[model samples]
Target: MFPNEWLWRNKLIALLVLVIVIELVLFLVPWERF
Candidate 1:
């Protein structure tokens, strides 16, 4: 695989993981305290 392609793929995977984490946090935390 090309280096640039590998880098982009890694970035996409990282972004997805971050989104999932944020979603989980929002779902588990109470909204009234904010």
Candidate 2:
């Protein structure tokens, strides 16, 4: 049970980081063509 909880937390953190990186990329790059 402890291992499962730890994995879940890691997954959540990874997802959050991925979202932040995506947001940063969008902010830095111009999307006028899209």
Candidate 3:
């Protein structure tokens, strides 16, 4: 119920979303030159 706890949860969710987006871009891109 604390505000700090709520903020921390939001931060974690944002981090997870960012990671997923990065993974998707990497998978979708066809950069075989690496």
Q: For candidate 1, write residues 1-34 as lDDT tens digits.
A: 5799899999999999999999999999999999
Worst 10 residues of 3 by lDDT: 25-34
Best by TM-score: 1
Where does candidate 3 clash, by residue pair?
none
Residue 16 lDDT (model 1):
100
TM-score of 2: 0.81
Task: Give the TM-scores of the predictions, in the order they appear.
Answer: 0.84, 0.81, 0.83
In model 2, which runs have C-alpha deviations exceeding 4 angstroms? none
Comparing 2 with 3 on lDDT, the higher-scoring candidate is 3
The runs of at least 3 residues in candidate 1 whose Cα sits more than 4 Å from the true structure, single-residue gaps closed, are none
Would you list the clashing residue pairs of candidate 1?
none
* Predictions: Cα RMSD each: 1.9, 2.0, 2.3
- Find the number of clashing residue pairs for candidate 2: 0
* Cand. 2 Cα-lDDT: 0.94
Residue-wise C-alpha lDDT for candidate 2, range 1-34, written one tens digit per residue: 5788899999999999999999999998888968
lDDT of 1: 0.97
Taking all chains together, the TM-score of candidate 3 against the true structure is: 0.83
